[model samples]
Target: MTMIFGIPIQAFLGQLLVGLINGSFYAMLSLGLAIIFGLLRIINFAHGAQYMLGAFIGYLLLADLGIGYWPALVLVPLIVGLFGMAVERFALSRLYGVDQLYGLLFTFGLALVIEGVFRYYYGVSGQPYAPPPLLSGGTNLGFMFLPNYRGWVVVASLVVCFGTWALIERTRLGSYLRAATENPRLVQAFGVNVPLLLTLTYGLGSGLAGLAGILAAPVYQVSPLMGSDIIIVVFAVVVVGGMGSILGAIVTGYVLGLAEGLTKVFYPEASNIVVFVIMALVLLVRPAGLFGRDG
Candidate 1:
């Protein structure tokens, strides 16, 4: 048997894979949170619920219309993005220019309402969504076995993360977006529709969460509690990464996920709480957050 740092390579690599998988979700979800907060200045408590909604939408599409995961992969996020856009246009837009707490509370209420509706209809049981046939099996990579679906998830998420980062950091539209956030009035005066941009930004963030949701559907149960279960951890990821730091969210998510996975292998007792412990430390050491700029 081979050993890696005194532990079986299989055990180490298995946990590492698990960490990477978890990190994928964390990175995508927290990226959305960071984007919304960074650009819109709204802390969206409904993000998790939106993620749940995305999964549900995909499940429903498959069940009702015989639409497969492939179709839902794109359709669900677009649907959820539109829903988020509607929310921003009609509801969330109203709360802008007020205390941020109001936005927070409003989103919290929105999440509750959405979750309650789903629970009332679907009950609390977990529903499984099958992965596509192409992603059905595992591969032997000499040192370890890797599930095709899980590997796809990690690769897909990395692509998405970097692609999003590029869109925001290296594009003309992104420059306008950052400029709008920094000076909405100036952008508006220059003939840019700042409100429209705000709505689109929220939509994009919600769309990212929705993408995470559908991606997660085959990996986890499609449950109403799904959002609530993982949301707190994601929020912690955002805080550790810095509230409005896009790159920070992506990096911190993957790193903390690896840390959590390794902890499970080495110290099972602390696996669940490891992320929180790190979060606490980061908070104490840098209240502005690891990637946050001090005001």
Candidate 2:
């Protein structure tokens, strides 16, 4: 058996694949964070809760209504987006003119409330969600066996990331979004509905989290506890990537995941700390992050 750096190639490749899968989740979650922070300028501490809500919603749809993965992928995001809008209207929106710390505090409290409510009803035990029949098998490539759903996740995440990047970077609506992020008052003078745009942007961010949750449902146990488990590492990923750039978030997620995978193969004990270590190094070298623009 061939080896890379004294580790068996098959083992290395398996870890690499696992890393990519984890990276997909990181990328999706961080993308949502980047969008919310960029446009709304609020640190959405409730993001993880919203992600959990997405998975739970998807699971309920599947169990109760017999809805499948494909439709839930589309509808769950919408449901979560609406939930985000309600949050903005009832809770977050009220804080728009206050100190930034107020927004952070509000969202943190909201996270606790959301998590506590779910815990009260469901307990912390996890539930399994089956992958759609179409994505249940694996293909044996000459190099390795690749599970179809895992492959689909990688491709879908890439497509969504790049598509979002293009939408924000190239389109006219995206142009307006960029302008609003830069100077909302100036954009408003040009006849754009900046507040509405802000609401929509937050909704979009929350919707992405929802989509990620739905995607993750089949892979991870659908539990109220899922978001709390991953959100910290994701925050570290956002810090490393630079919180403001969409493309940077995606790149950082994949790179960090690969790094973690390599660590798992060579030094199992260091794998968990690797991301935080990189985050520290990035903070020391570039406090604004790998792609952030200093304000």
Candidate 3:
């Protein structure tokens, strides 16, 4: 068996695949965070809860409503995204002119409330969610076997990430969003509904989180604690990538995920701390983050 860096090639490949899978999640989650923060300037602490809601909603649809994964993929995000728009309109919108901490605290409290409500009903146990029938099997690649669902996740995430990037960087609507972020008053003067834009942006960000949650439902158990467990690592990814930087968030997420996976192969003990260590190093070198602009 061929070996790379003293590790078996198969093992290395396996870990690399796992890293890419994980990186997909990180990229999706952090991408949402970047979008929300970029335009709204609000640190959305409730994002994880929104993700949990997505998975739970998907599970409920499958179990009770008889909706399959394919449909839920479309419905769940829409539902959650609309819900998020409502949240911004009723709650978050009230804090726009207030201190930034107010927005943060509101989201943090919202997270706790959401988690508490789910825990009260679900009892903290992981609910099982099976992948769709069409994606249930594995594919053999001679060297490493790839799960069809996992592969779909990686591809879907990449599509979503790049698609979002293109939408923001290349599209006319994206131009308005960027303009509003820079000067909401000026954009409003041009008859572009700035408040509506903010609401939609938050909704879009939350919807992305929901989409990620639905994708993760089959891979990880649909549990209320799932979001909390992953959100910290994602936050570290955001910090390293530079908060509010769309491209930075995407790149950092994948890079850190691969780094973490490699760490697990080389030094199992430090696997957990590797991301944090890297975050600390990034902070020391560039406090604004790898892609963050020094303000």
Candidate 4:
């Protein structure tokens, strides 16, 4: 058995794989939060609810309509994104220009309501979602056995995250989005639909959350409480990465996840709190966040 720093290589790589899996979820989720806050200036506490909603919707689709993972993977986000747009239009849109507290409170309340309904129906035990047949097995690496679905999750997340980054940083539409956030009135004067843009941006954020949810269904239990369990860590990821900093959100998620995994290897007791510890340290040194422009 090959050893790495006193641990078997297989054991080390196994933990690292776990870290990457967790990091994948973290990156997608924090990216969503960062996008919404960055562009909309609203802290959407309903995000976790949206994530739960996605999982539930996917579950329902499979249980009732015979929709499979592939379809759910596409449809779930679209549906959730549309729901997010509706919320932005009818509820969140009205809160703009008011105290930020109002938006926060409203989203928090929305989360509770959604979770309550789901719990009432699903009873919080959790539902099992099987991975697609194509991704049902594992591949043996030199050191460890790698699950196909897990590998897919990592690849899909990186593709989506970087693809999103490219869209915002490299495209003309992205330019308009950034500009609108900077000066909506000016952008509107230039014939841009700022409100619509904001609505779509929020939808995109929510959709990312949903996508994460669905991808996670096979890896973890699909439950109303699932989102709540992960959202807090995702928020911590956002904070440490610098709130609203897209690049920061993506990077910090993976970094903290790896740190957490390694901590579990070195100090199992500290694994759970590692992300929070990093958040506290980052806050003390730089409240603006690692990538945030604000101070």
Candidate 5:
């Protein structure tokens, strides 16, 4: 019966929850984009397809092979990562020395082929992916009733996002990745296999996308088209975050998500456009995003 700013408190909380859930996906996808763009200077249009592949792989593992979610979570990314590595090796690697536009175009064509193939086989309809048994229920959190699956999603995504940030910003492997990003020739001269590092980085980025897809499967419909639908919004998030910074990607995603949720409560009409609007504002003011370093 209580209301906050003339909206039912429950409704407000619910929308906020939805926003956070959407934000989790945005964070993961944009993080991958940042990684690729910062290092390889490629705008990978096929990331959405990679995400779809992740979900499809997870579903196939469960429905056909009788594998469960826990294991699928681990295996799906590895599978998707290998696929990404192969794409980079055979297809994308050739374009590295050329104009960056070529990289974009190549990935865009690859995205189309991937999405078209999946649509041909699976159609555009959504498929349900049930949450694991342990995450199917909800908890009464006094102020809000939270679904276990959603809670798990937020927590798991936070862990992955921060963990990745730490690994890249703090660890020795991260140092190499950064070094490769900054000066590949120098890093190569130092005996770090730069090309292999690039491949691994691409695989790692794509694998993160896959992991996100697996997390999203139970929360959203598992459909071939799901990736395309969300990818645009994520791209906007990346733009607003500025592609140079990893932490910026993570922060932008969660912030925009909460902003969208608040907008839905205050003015439903603006919720969809809020992200783009923020991106425009960021371009006008900072031009490098909240946490981005000037390139």
Candidate 6:
């Protein structure tokens, strides 16, 4: 049997592929977190709930309404994004002038409420969501058979991550967002509608989470506890990547995901804590994170 580093090469490749798929979710979620935190200075604890909501919404659209995955792909995010915007307008907006802890507590409470409601209705059992008919098959790469949907997930996630980075780093509206993050009062004086921008920024972040959830639905079971399960790792990714650095979040997400995968192969027991261990090391060496700007 072929071996690399005392492990079968095939197994290694499989794990790497799995890591990439998981990394895709990490990148998308962390990117959204970075965006919201950068502008709103709010650590959105409800982000995971939003993600679960996206999956549930996508599932409902397909199962009950007879909507297919293709349409749900577009509609789910729009619906959740509007819901997020409403949250900002009706709830989070009120906390802007108060202590940051208030925002954190409110979001945390919101997460519990959303999760509890879903639990009451759906229970904790996982619900299966099938992929679109087009993505039902697998491709035989010479060394490994790759599922078409997994491949699509990797490609889609990359496109979304890069697109988001370009929007935040290269576009004019993104420039306003960056400037507003620095000094909203000054940006407002310059005629930019900072308040509206803030609302949209939170909506955009929430929308990203929704998109991730939709993508994840076919890969994982849609369950009430799904969001809480993944959000902690995502928070670690955010901390390691630096709160406001968009590119850092994207990079750290994939790297940590891969690291976690490799750990599973070589050190199964440590796999769960590997990301946190890396996070702790990163924090000890550079409190601002690998790409964060020094204060």
Which digits, one per residue and each the tens of the lDDT, describe model 2 over residues 24-112?
Answer: 98999999998888777888888898999999999999999999999999999999999998888778888886788999898889888
Shift of residue 263 alpha carbon in model 3, Å: 0.7
Return the lDDT, model 5, position 71.
96
Global Cα lDDT for candidate 4: 0.92
Model 5, span 171-268: residue lDDT tens: 99999998997888999999999889889989989999999999999998889898888888888899888875889899999989999999999999
lDDT of each: 0.95, 0.90, 0.94, 0.92, 0.90, 0.94
Question: Which portions of model 3 show Cα errors greater than 4 Å?
Answer: none
Candidate 1 global lDDT = 0.95
Best model number under lDDT? 1
How do all models score by TM-score?
0.98, 0.97, 0.98, 0.98, 0.97, 0.98
At residue 295, candidate 4 shows an lDDT of 44
Provide the clashing-pair count of each candidate structure. 0, 0, 0, 0, 0, 0
- List pairs with backbone clashes in candidate 2: none
Q: Tell me the spans in candidate 6 whose CA falls farther than 4 Å from its real position.
A: none
- Per-residue error for 60 in candidate 6, Å, reads 0.2
Which residue pairs clash within candidate 4?
A: none
Ranking by lDDT: 1, 3, 6, 4, 5, 2
Candidate 2: list runs displaced more than 4 Å. Answer: none
Question: Which pairs in model 1 have colliding backbones?
Answer: none
